[model samples]
Target: MRKTTFLLPIIVIVVAGLMSALFIVDEREKALVLQFGRVVAVKEDPGLAFKIPLIQEVVRYDDRILSRDVEPLEVTPLDDRRLVVDAFARFRIADVTQFRQAVGVGGVATAENRLDSILRAETREVLGSVTSKDILSSDRAALMLRIRNSAIFEARGLGLEIIDVRLKATDLPKQNLEATFERMRAEREREATDERARGHEAAQRVRALADRTVVELVSEAQREAEIIRGEADALRNNIFAEAFGKDPEFFEFYRSLTSYQRALKGSNSSMVMNPDSEFFNYLRSPSGGRAVTPPAPLPQAQVDAAEGAALEAAEADAAAGTAASEAQEEAETDVNNYEVDQVEDAEDGVQN
Candidate 1:
């Protein structure tokens, strides 16, 4: 029993010692062995690892990509513009041994601080060479590339591999931004006013041209209407002349009858004529102006009827002659008035 007790304790102590000496590392981690607070060795793989119990220790480091967000920086451009630049970087440990020696294990905070300083220095150097417009637009990509290359070169000695350098945002100070906005608004308003003035001038030109075209069109239409009316009148006169030329005597007799009807139909007028007047001769003598033999006395009823018919015929002839004379006089008067008007118009045109 004494021998069994002694072996059980020895086994327990052995198990405890083994447990203390053995270490575990995950696949994503790298561990460094330290003895008496000094780094002795590093393990860069997964699975079980060994160490001196209670004397040697393991310090783990992340063997993966890491990120750091830099603080905002003030930068001035070539155009004397100032802006706030916010940036970030992605990085990883490229040489674990060098990293431990330079920054110590689990020294990401220190490395980030150093990187931020380098980033700020490089950002100033690059951005200072550019104008504000370039920094805001075309040169931004080139600037970022230059910064990344410079940061990578600088981080080489620190055992850090810079994966990317990016400018997240660039902004003007609030007060300066408000001033720029006001200037832009004023410029836009000026352009709008100029455009409106141009539009008004163009509209005036179009309206004037339209007015001139309207006047020209109206004048042309009036001239064409006058020409058409004159042609129609000429055609009507030619047709009348042809019809009248075919039967002159009948035309004259018809005209006389028309005159008599117009003059006497609605008139109450007294008339006097010489015995030898053609109007009376037509009623007294049937042989056109020659005298006829006197006849035996006729019945009173028959004589009265004959005399009444002759008087009516004479009165009608006299009425026709008077109306013809009046119509001729009116025509002459109209011709004289028209001539006077034309002469006055011609004189006025000459004076003007």
Candidate 2:
């Protein structure tokens, strides 16, 4: 029983020693074996690993891709415009031995610190070489590649492989933001003013054209009306002339009646004229009594011849004077009676 106890203690000590010499590495990570603060071996594969018991130690590092965000940086572009740039980077540890040697016991924290500095420097350098317009354009991928390439070259010494560099945002500084907006507003206002001026000019041109067209139309209409009125007046004058030529006495009588109708249209009509005026001629005598030119008188020689013939005939007819006077009187009476009948018939026809 005493021997069994003693053997048990020895076996436990051996197990402890074996355990101290062995380690396991996951596929997701890499490890380094350090002796007295010196790197002696690197474990790149997964599964089991070895180390000197109580003499060497193992340090682990992730083998996958990692990301780091760089603090916002201000850069002056080639155009003298300043901007704030926010960025980040993706990277992985390419060499564990070189990493351990560079960072020593600082681990990932120290490596990330140095990497941030590298990215910031490269970002400023690359961004400062271009104008602000290009930085904000769709072709920014090329600029990001430039920064990543530069960072890769600089991070090689720290055992870091830079995968990519990306810009989250590029904006004006807070102090310049309001100023830029004001400038943009002013430019837009100027453009609007120019557009309004052009519109006004075009409207004025159309208005002038319309006004001129109205005047021309009115003038043409007036001319047409005047021409029609002139033609109607000419036709009326021709009708009046034909009526006058056919019968002057009837024309005058009709004209007088028309004048009386127009002058005495209302019950309150009045007139002041002589009772025997020529205007009353048609009213007093229905048969026209207009003056006419008389036939020329006989010549002086014919007057003496007519007087001698009348004397001879008077002496010869002395005996028959009484009978002749009675016969002539009866003939005159018949002629006068015929004239009276003609006048009465004319009056009856006019009345009808």
Query: lDDT scores for all predictions?
Result: 0.73, 0.78
lDDT of 2 by residue, 1-352 (tens): 9999999999999999999999999999999999998989999899999999999999999999999999999999999999999999999999998888899889889999999999999999999999999999988999999999999977989999999999999999999999998898777666656555555565555555555554555455445444544554454455556546566656667788888778776874878899788777767775546653332443555455445444544544452444445545555555455545555554444344
Per-prediction TM-score to the true structure, in the order listed: 0.60, 0.70
In candidate 2, stretches whose alpha carbon ends up further than 4 angstroms from where it belongs are: 244-352
Off by over 4 Å in 1: 221-352
| lDDT, model 2, position 96 | 90
Question: In model 1, what are the clashing residue pairs, if there are any?
Answer: none
Best by TM-score: 2
**Which one wins on lDDT?**
2
